[model samples]
Target: MAAVRKSTNWFAIGVTAAVLVVVLIVAGVVWFANSQATSPGTLPESSAVNTETGAIAVGSGDKTVDTYIDFMCPVCNQFEQAYGPTLDQLVASDEITLNIHPISILDRASQGTEYSTRSASAAYCVAVDDAANVPAFVKALYAQQPSENTAGLDDATLASVAASVGASDAATSCISDGTYTRFVTAMTQNTPVQPGSGGIATPTIAVNGTVLSNQTDLTGDPQKDIVDRLNG
Candidate 1:
């Protein structure tokens, strides 16, 4: 009985060791893949654009507010509808600097269209060409937000959207050529993981550099919550 028990213990130890090794190998591969991801070269330059963080800056004020949004995220559209006016008012009053980070993590949901990346890249194109019109372009994109798992608006329609917002001249070519797709990917990868969350999520809001919780902090009333956060 003692001999059998000793053999069983050794077998269990060996199996556990093998599992640990496999887990370590998987972790290492994931880390390596992330490390080797594509790099964004020559960031878009504009007075209203943050070249370092890939955020489109709106309004210059004492306080800073950041929003990391995925174009294909429906919740982001809801966020925009709810808080867009409030943010605009704050910007107009010069109370807070709004940093809009256009990111793309839902490209897979776009049915091979890569709409998330394309739209984000188009926004960057607008930032490079007509910085002042970027906000309008964003609003337009959200207004025409496509359903998930559907092929999102095509390149021509994206350019048309830019034109509708008076960003046609250079933006059209930029969108058509997908000038900042890689940059969008890098920005998406760099999106800050919200507090209490393990991964990046759309419509991540940060006030004065503190990420807010959408479930607890933003559940009751987002507009009021954002204003209170800014004021507080």
Candidate 2:
């Protein structure tokens, strides 16, 4: 009887161990699934007419011009102030498709406010809420860009800027709530591996999928240079 009891006890112990292992495995799978479900996928209500690869795009021309910029970069601000009008004109005339990629390379420069991310996320909000006004909203944001090391614009200021560009209350709410912050974070992380755009820096310009290495003169007329490049 003692021998039989010992054998039965061993079997019970083995069964209990097996059940515990299965429970652990099931718990791990559930946690992984939940994490994946919470991860950000793509921008909400993204439209191809004004967005591609997480960029705010305008125009439907044959030639493509991709502009990567960080709002906190002074040099990027200069580039925008110099070439913004020209780019807008080209897009308006359908001479070239203009795709503006708002990235968050300078998040650290905002003194812990993560201004670059906030601004980029706000831009995404504008894109989702008011796609047609994206260009205007971008120009306005650059116009009021704060210097690095500052706290950057607060949420109210950002919302006001959006309102100035005819963005509705929905856009303001979206910006305030940071609805697309996770999406912006994901886009920034994937910038290097972006299809047809490998390892880019701020103010990076690409014409027809060809990235430019040399900096074009900010003072010189970019219209002619852009036209030549497109024609070339």
Evaluate all candidate structures by whole-model CA lDDT and list the values in order: 0.88, 0.78
Give residue 108's error in model 2 in angstroms: 0.6
Residue range with the least summed lDDT across 10 consecutive positions in model 1:
1-10
Give one digit per residue, the lDDT tens place, for model 1 in 1-232: 5665433588888999999999999999999887767668547878887766888998888898899998889999998988888889999999999999999989999999999999999999999998889889999999899999999999999999999999867889999999989888877777888778887888898989998877776764655688888777
Best by the TM-score measure: 1
lDDT of 2 by residue, 1-232 (tens): 5665433588888999999999999999999998766566445686742323666777888888888778888878887877778888888899888987778888898989989988888888787877788888888988898999999999999999989998899988888888777766666654543334455567777778766653442335685656677888
Give the Cα error of residue 118 in candidate 1, in Å.
0.4
Range of the 10 consecutive residues with the lowest summed lDDT in candidate 2 = 189-198
TM-score per candidate, chains pooled: 0.82, 0.80
Question: How big is the positional error of residue 8 in model 2, measured in Å on the Cα after superposition?
Answer: 6.8
Candidate 2 lDDT score relative to the true structure: 0.78
Q: How close is candidate 2 to the true structure, as a TM-score?
A: 0.80
